[model samples]
Target: MVVEGAGPSCGLIDGFGRHVTYLRLSVTDRCDLRCVYCMSEDMSFRSRRDILTLEELTRLARLFIARGIDKLRITGGEPLVRPGILDLFAALSEPIADGSLRELTLTTNGTQLARFAEDLARAGVRRINVSLDTLDPERFRALTRGGSLARVMDGIAAARAAGLTVKLNVVALKDGTEHEIHDLIAFAHAREMALSLIETMPLGDVGVDRVDQYLPLDSLRRQIAGRWTLHDVPMRSGGPARYARVAETGGLIEFITPHTHNFCADCNRVRVTASGTLHTCLGQDDATDLKAHLRTSATDDVIVRLIDQALGRKPKGHDFILRRGASPQLARHMSETGG
Candidate 1:
């Protein structure tokens, strides 16, 4: 089902000329931990009936692969929590096993990775990003509300032990303590893994005043630049994060600054929620509901056309900017957005 072209429009090119080749698929919105930055303590999740079936998920992913999406990422409230997720993994891995999809990756909280790491490695998942904002047990519990830092640490160790290319993700808030930031850098250096520092996006309740929490990553970058001689790494993935290696530690750090840097101009990825809604840009609310189309008599070609219709009109970029009293928000939260 290749789109029958070798140009920008061959896959998922927008009017702005950015060739989209990455897909982030949210398998479910049910998370075991209520991270303070991601959701409210009493948040409600979608019912099981609303989620896409395993077959539906596979069909949608296959169509995207045909359209030239070489890299596919699995995300969720915490992707490992979904039952029958291994089946879905096996189904999605078929193309990769045969050399159709270039890479299949995942992003998770790491709380569940300890048990799933071996299975994930065996299922053809080669790379993963684990979210850990702090290393202190009390701080971890405070941020995630009952999440065990030890469990997440165990998960991290298991992921590495299973031979997975593990990367750590951290949300650097404006009010973060210097000790935690430095310690996290040290931790990554110890493991010899890349650490991606992400600035908080004003999405969902996350149970905090996002404006108060928002931090410009430039300062953090300067702070690290002062300590270590950093070397720039070339960008191969269309994802927005910028990379550099610490000359002293051989540890890498990628900064994904959506509000501060706004990579939307050159963004080359789109997202699909667990229930089959497609969002062309993370900073914009523009989305098309594809569940109805998939559940009906719609053909793959028709689905492809609908995707074209959505990407063709992709917004120039997200409009929300951080400022005093700014209350930037989206209709859907991080849970639904698949992070």
Candidate 2:
């Protein structure tokens, strides 16, 4: 079932002409944690039939990799919650190891990583991104409803012990968990891992509908009164992001200011949801039903055309933070967006 024309044949000349290399794949829309920032208490999950089978996922990955997607990221409501996740990793990473793909990574809530991190690393997951909003136990319990801070902490240790390139993702909210910024930085520095403080995007079901608490990351950066210099890590040669290391005598930190600094200029990625839709941008809700297409026209040429069209439709970049009217694609819940 190796589709022919899908062999790295389709790409476009963007305004700057960068070939898209990264692809984020959502394996399941079901997550175990009902984080206050994502879904509500009674939010329903996507039907089981909607999720791509492991074979279907591997086939999709193969087709995309054949189309010049060099880097792959596995995301979900909580990627690990999906059954056969490690097997999925094995399935996806084997192609990369065999030279059909270049990189493979996973994003998880860290609650489930403690038991599986070592196995994931062994299965060829080179990098890991763990989501942790607050360090305070009670506050964490509040932020991610029913999540235990201790469990997440153990997961982090397990991930580090497994030799994965770990990165901590923190969503900075104004009055809620902004107080944990310094603590997060200290933790990352102590463990020699990258800590990225993300600006809260207004994209969630009930959690973000109450998005009034979104923090301006620039203000967060400026509030660090202590003199610390940042050294730019060039991403222009590039894969996923434009990152910098914050340096000050004894320690350093990595900050990903995606909102303040629009990496979209050099953005070389697209996302496919768990149900098999191709999304050009998380902020712009333009997506094509790749799953339906796969069921009908599994031909490589047809798939390539759809991917090229989707890439061409990618918005210039998202300016929702600056604009007031409202954005159509910007309001979907993060759970649905797989990030």
Scored by CA lDDT, what does every candidate get? Answer: 0.85, 0.75
Cα error, residue 222 of model 2, in Å, equals 1.0
Best-performing candidate as measured by TM-score: 1
Predicted structure with the largest lDDT when compared to the true one: 1
- lDDT of candidate 2 at residue 284, scale 0 to 100: 74
lDDT score at residue 282, model 2, on the 0-100 scale: 72
Estimate the overall C-alpha local distance difference test score of candidate 2.
0.75
Lowest-scoring 10 consecutive residues by lDDT in candidate 1? 1-10
TM-score of 1: 0.94
Q: What does each candidate score in C-alpha RMSD?
A: 2.2, 2.6
Candidate 2 ranges with C-alpha deviation above 4 Å = 9-16, 207-211, 225-229, 236-242, 249-254, 322-331
What is the C-alpha lDDT profile of model 1 across 227-327, one tens digit per residue? 77889998746677889888888888999888767677678899999999999988788889888888984467668888989989898887666565555
Model 1, 97: alpha-carbon shift in Å? 1.0
